[model samples]
Target: MAYISVLKLILSVYCFFTLFILCSTAPELCNFPAIFNFGDSNSDTGGFSAALFSLPPPYGQTFFHMPAGRYSDGRLIIDFIAESLNLPHLQAYLDSLESNFTHGANFATSASTIRLPNRVLPCGSGFSPFYLNVQYGQFHQFKSRADFIRTRGDIFGSLLPREEDYLRALYTFDIGQNDLGEGFFRNKTIKQVYASIPDIINQFTVDVTNIYWVGARSFWIHNTGPVGCLPYILTTFKTAGKDSAGCAKAYNEVAKYFNLKLKEAIGQLRKELPSSAFTYVDVYSVKYSLFTHPKKYGFELPLVACCGYGGKYNYNNEVTCGYTLKMKNGSEIVVGACEKPWKRVNWDGIHYTEAANKFVFNKISTGAFSDPPRPLKQSCFNPS
Candidate 1:
């Protein structure tokens, strides 16, 4: 009902379609037009702060040079995707004051769950503006605004995207970790969490279908990464027994099961939408490699939390990675970033460092992490 600026979104979508028509090289994929992403902190651009928490200093100190609510020190996987495509990084939809939508809008937020009924994380709320369903609602609003401008052709002029343009744009989903996280945090075993996989993937499938009905045919859905390797999970769920890699076996097993179900759902969805390109990104193997084979990737301690203060894992689950606490001995303990964040795998116990993000992105774009085997650009461009 209110006036929403969707010019950036429309232009971005339209430009991507133009890219597909223009470029076709295997090495340089300048042929990318735009991407619409829905996910949690892993791909969040700044939705966390725009809608909820304000990430403080050292969060973006590595590359952004300031705290941008990114939950990381630099670019995220989504940022790398945009960089690979030669598109401007997307702006968080809620950060409208000085936001630029030249590329597209990011509807992701920190601790966002795929299904709303699932309990919200202890750090975040459960409902509107954070769930994928809520994000989808916002996207519907975005599409409507784009439709309005294109139909009227009033003030936006040529930047408006035709309806088909919006339909053809790439839609990426990197959510679901928090949904399972809720269960794990509750002390549910991996087998217990497995029972919810079907419902989770089913809800995800419904959301994808909702977008497909609106014309989005290019889908890049990232399966959950290796959550057990996260410092937070390792610390919170550690037992006497440990994996050979020192990572939590239960959490990773949960991730594997979820990914398997997600892949199957995508396979079935492919049959449902024969003309659409639905690629499931295998981020687990890529991310897990950083832990299992840290030396090969130049990481010294892949299991250590890059920013945890005064803890074995560098992650004080009780204290997070920001702010300070007063101790019993009249001493104050503060949480902050690591000195060598670039060389570490995990960031703040939960997310990955920028260096790790780039590594995963590189592997994914190599055409190996994707199903149906093709570079991300080719899959996006050729949805047939």
Candidate 2:
């Protein structure tokens, strides 16, 4: 009898442990029907670079083994987010020749802007002279992108008719960093640009609200990261006493101010679009944490870029990373990468590596940056 009782106790304990493991690992049911992504290089799959005439290496070497037009190695935050939801990486609307939009699409561009066009210039001039021209052009691109979606929606709707029932989807907007980097910071003083953040964010809110009116039911918006910490800023503007370890307080503070206002703007949007779900993903904090606590996140080099000349910028924006190499005495001369690529934080002066993007995606999906009232919960589940 004693032996039988001990056996039963052991069986019960085993069952309990099994149940706990299953519960912890089980996937949650995804509430979203689809995902729509709009942003710059951080989330852009291959839209802008593909559109451009120039081809650069070291662009997609991290993931695709060749340049896929993505700025990172393999996948980005949006790609990971799609995977977490059991969805494929968002397709570029431009690449939708057949209009098969079963999983939604990405309409982001590397150097795109959200503001209205201020002027118009001839095509292939390298830059869109005015904000209005770029805005209208991008809007047209967005419309073209949507046409592709409609085509896919029509086909998918016929096959999976219930998809429309869950038509409510998540849309992530992650742009504006370039506008600051190229436009404001390039010419104006940090003080001047800092003063204009409210205006920029306000206009962004309006643009996002318009997107919401179109078809975005759930939104994930991201604010700018700490620009001062970027390799370009650190190298170009570092004071005599301020080293790479110490970032410019003023620049970081401005980013904080912008983030605060952005949070407020999101709050207002939530109140205005009460029926829709809007979540803000704080990219600033995630990237900053990587720099501040590199060891905690398993990174060793926080400030250095994996590709680029060993200089202030740590990047040659005019040239691609791995694909293009200058030869000296029959030896290739290029930016040196860290010994442990995965352990480094910054891939280039401005971008994160595939691993870093994965880390950021996990945080966003888990509600590390979500606002209250609609925090992220489990995303999948398995009955077995």
Candidate 3:
């Protein structure tokens, strides 16, 4: 009888310790070790600027106090995300000088598209050569080289990620806007652009799968924002029909269609990759809200560029935000930025101001603009 009693007591103690350990280890919020970002200008920290020419002053005036290689006057959405998660800002993969890959890397670049452009940068148009597939290739090389270098156990090892960090890392994507933009700029009709979406989405799916094959498990994919509301679009497509919010109606419809397809693809991916957690962020809705009700969000002139020259939208493609032009009287004059960039939504007619990016980040980080309604902190947890 004493032996049986002792056995029961041992079992009880074991159960108590097991429960305590489980409860203690259970995460209240996701603990992401790193972030691997892929996309276009929206998330490009300095990829394009490093590959091409360095952006001039006033580009990062609002926060960095100098040119920081970001398209905005200050920080980008990805910058805010890294700050929220207590991770260091990701350096561009293309940036060879002073780059540390310990946390993660950003493969995004300005004018990047899902599909490879017909002509690359400084050619037919200003499209980036580092498209989605190229970015994946770069990532593949990075992973392999990182492993090879870490085996040496030198100081370089400390500047690279641990093998397990890739599995726990959050993979972020904010691409595909340029695909639609490409179709439109190439003189493809609205119907033609719509027809091209399936192929665009297929490429996106393939790229995501490629990343997954490389051991990425947590995904935070942001759908493209409302391109129709951009000052560049509004200024260029002058004949397009306008919505109640003064945005291009047909262009927004195309964006909605693309978003719908992307959502569906994510749902399929969830079922296919049961071990992975995919979070679809509806940035389009949050951005559209800013345009519709600018005053509600403490913004004015939602459609105008904070820095540009000429035209009704204060944007002229011939003379961009930072260009210096020689006057007919033989005097040099810089275009310069607006006095108050924080009060405006658009920056240089193509990107958002730092203030606008922060606002969008605030809204989406709450999970209100996310599909499955999961906050960014809990993105690794799959919804039951």
TM-score of 2: 0.77
lDDT of 2 by residue, 1-384 (tens): 999999999999999999999998765545666666777777777666556533365555666777676776567888888887787777765564444455666777666555642332235323323232343344445545555555775553442213342235667778767666654444677778777778878888777776665545667777778776777667656572343455656667777887888889889987887767667778888888887888998987677777667565466554435544566667666544555667776776777788888887777676767675233433211123
Top lDDT model = 3
Question: Which residue ranges in model 1 land beyond 4 Å of their true spot?
Answer: 1-30, 117-129, 150-164, 329-331, 381-384
- In terms of lDDT, the poorest run of 10 residues in model 1 is 120-129
lDDT of 1 by residue, 1-384 (tens): 222457777788999988987766334432446678999999999887876668877788899998886988888999999888787888888886676554567899888888874455343535334688788888888878877766776665344345656655778889988888878777676777899889989999998888787777888889998888888887777682568899877778888999999999999999998878888899989998998899898887888877777567877766777778789999997777778888988888889999999999999987898897777887663543
State residue 127's C-alpha deviation in candidate 1, in Å.
Answer: 7.8
Model 1 clash pairs? 16-33, 167-215, 308-314
| lDDT of residue 275 for candidate 1 | 74
Worst 10 residues of 3 by lDDT: 375-384
Q: Residue 119 in model 3: shift from native, Å?
A: 1.4
Error of 1 at 163 (Å): 4.0
Q: Residue 300: error of model 2 in Å? A: 1.3
Q: Give a tens-digit lDDT track for model 3, residues 39-128.
A: 999999999999986788779999999988899999999999999999999899999999998889999999999998877986756699
RMSD of 3: 6.0
Better of 2 and 3 by TM-score: 3
